[model samples]
Target: MKSGDKVLETAGILVPKVCILGVTITLINKTTEYS
Candidate 1:
């Protein structure tokens, strides 16, 4: 149970970063495409 909780905590922290990174990459791609 403790290990599972730790994994979830780590994932919670990382998921937002991953989402932000994905969003940033997508925005950059769109901007470059338009320009």
Candidate 2:
């Protein structure tokens, strides 16, 4: 149970970072395409 909780906590921290990174990359690509 402790290990599962730890994994969930780590994922909770990482998921937002990963999502932000993906959004940034997409925005950069769109900007490049438009320019």
Which portions of model 2 show Cα errors greater than 4 Å?
A: none
Clashing pairs in 2: none
Model 2 local distance difference test score: 0.99
For model 1, residues 1-35, the per-residue Cα lDDT tens digits are 69999999999999999999999999999999999
- What overall lDDT, based on C-alpha atoms, would model 1 receive against the true structure? 0.99
TM-score of 2: 0.92
- Write down the RMSD of all candidates, one decimal each: 1.2, 1.2
- Whose TM-score is greatest here? 2
Tell me the tens digit of each residue's lDDT in model 2 across 1-35.
69999999999999999999999999999999999
